[model samples]
Target: MQDVRAGLISAFHWRSDPPVWPEHRIYYADDSAWWREPTILGELGSSLAALFSDEPPTVVMSPESRGSLLGPLVATHLGIGFAEVRKGAERASDDEVWLRRRTPPDYRDRHLEMAVRRSVLRTGDRVLFVDDWAATGAQAMACQQLAGDAGASWVGAAVIVDGLENSADRRLLMLRSLLHLRDLRRR
Candidate 1:
């Protein structure tokens, strides 16, 4: 995990003027490069897999965009199915369900809607939510709600970076990350 964290830290870039939110000055870590490389993705998947080894998930869910990339890789490594929660105006079929939540203006500062197909997630299924990063944990909370609505249980969350100050207060789900906000900020 330390090696993975080091790699991520070295690869990550920080900027004050983020495209989505320019007012806030913070350490921004771009995960696109890591997602594109198979070896890096595999290593990330392996680390997350080890974190969730004790509690294997039946299904892995991720929010659209970055989550879409990491979720599938982790799910594939764990031999589980991957489900995506669409953001924005994406529509789901009649059988699909949508879960919406309001996120703090930390990153995008907007309302986000996540959807999952009813057929893909079953009741009593253990789900692990995956994402590239978590700042305020608004998105992860929304994902947890989506899982609950689908009658699935949230096992935990796995991410490359954990930026939440009060991770325990976010929810009952355990969170595992390779790097943290402080780690990046210190750099």
Candidate 2:
């Protein structure tokens, strides 16, 4: 875990400009470096393992940014299937629901999508929502709504980091932060 953390701090130069804010700092970069850190990858995998080992067995996520990179890794770690919420248009007509995410001010005007493509949740399937980070939590709320609409049992939420100071929302059963902003503060 330390090695992964080291790689991410170096790769993203988190040491220089650690994304620490009085509130949430949802990463400053939107490039590959944000998702390429070894520590982040490992921490993501561990987060998945920790969450999936609990009651439920399935997971879903909203895609297009950090979640796009995170969803697959969590799915692979949990040995279960993963689905991405699509952005822009309605690609499917039936058997799926659509939700709009109001991202941070910086990500305003950007649309994010999350969907279940192959099979809808059956009678006893458990669903977990995973995202890269939590800032204002608009994205996470969108994901929770999607899970509810799908009729899947909502387990909880797991994140690479929880930038929000007050995280008392009920939807999150188990919340985990891989490497916090303080862990990467500028020296």
Candidate 3:
């Protein structure tokens, strides 16, 4: 875990320019470095997998884009299947049920649709949601809703970095991450 944390910290890049939102004045942590190297991703996946080892997950679900990358790696390490939540209605199948999700401003601040084949997620299956990062947790909440719709049990959520501030809702969910935003903030 220490090695993975060190690698991520060393590879992380803090942007000099502030975000459009004044509240987000701290530089954004560039995540490309972690995605570029297989070793780093594997280490992250391994660490994430370890979090749920006691109660292994039956399926790993992730949203489109970065989640598509890290989710599979974690599933591979855990020897489980992976399911993808498509980004839009266009990618959804006519036969599948589409769940619409609203993301916070930090994550494009738009509504996105996600779906999983009914056959892919079965009832009673334990699901672990994986993503590269979580700030306001809009995406994770959507994924959880997706799991709920499918009747799968949400085991928890795992991510590379967590940026959410303390909140009552967050306290109710089991969210694990290798690093927090404070860990990467420019000091």
Candidate 4:
């Protein structure tokens, strides 16, 4: 765990410039370094999965972006299956049914609709949401709603960097993270 934490911190990079970010300087993260490191890659799954060792989920679910990367690792560590949560219900027809929910405004204040296939998340399955980061937890809220719709119990979320601005969201998501956003902030 110590090695993983050190590896994660050393691998992280943030970018902020006057020309690019004048007043509102949001974190421009470059997290590709750790992805290439063999040791970090090997430890990520086990470290993140250890966060919820006691109450392990039946299935791990994550959004299709970066979450897809970490979710599988946690699932593999826990010896459980992983479900990919898709963003948006782009194609709607009589073909397949999806459990969907519109998220509240995120860090960028953009509302997005996240979805998961009904078949992937079965009824009565315990779901653990794993992701790379959580800024506003809008996506986590949507995930919780989708889990409810599927009749699956939500076991909470595990993330690498938790930057949540609201204490309510922190509690609501039951967020556990390896590093707080403040740990990486410019000091």
- List TM-score per model, in order: 0.83, 0.68, 0.86, 0.92
lDDT (0 to 1) per candidate: 0.76, 0.58, 0.79, 0.88
Top candidate, metric lDDT: 4
Q: How far is 73's C-alpha from truth in model 3 (Å)?
A: 0.5
Query: By summed lDDT, which 10 consecutive residues of candidate 4 come out lowest?
Result: 18-27
Q: If both were scored by lDDT, which would come out higher, candidate 1 or candidate 4?
A: 4
* Tens digits of per-residue lDDT for model 3, 132-181: 88877877887787788878899998988888786653654488888888
lDDT of 1 by residue, 26-87 (tens): 65556666766666666887787777788989999988888887888789899989988776
lDDT digits (tens) for residues 1-187 of candidate 2: 5555565556554322444774654535332575665555666566555655655566655456667777777778777767676545364567554544433332354445544443544434576667766665656666666666666776767765566555575235445555565655553
Give Cα distance to truth, residue 174, candidate 2, Å: 4.2
10 residues in a row with least lDDT, candidate 1: 96-105
Model 3 spans > 4 angstroms off: 18-26, 91-93, 96-106
User: Where's the lowest-lDDT run of ten residues in candidate 3?
Assistant: 97-106
Q: lDDT by residue for model 4 over 1-187, one digit each (tens)?
A: 8888888888888876655646677658777898899999999999888888888799999997989999999998899999899887665678888888999998789999899989899999999999999988989889999999999999989999998988888998988998888777553
Model 2 gets an lDDT of 0.58
Q: How far is candidate 2 from the true structure (C-alpha RMSD, Å)?
A: 5.4
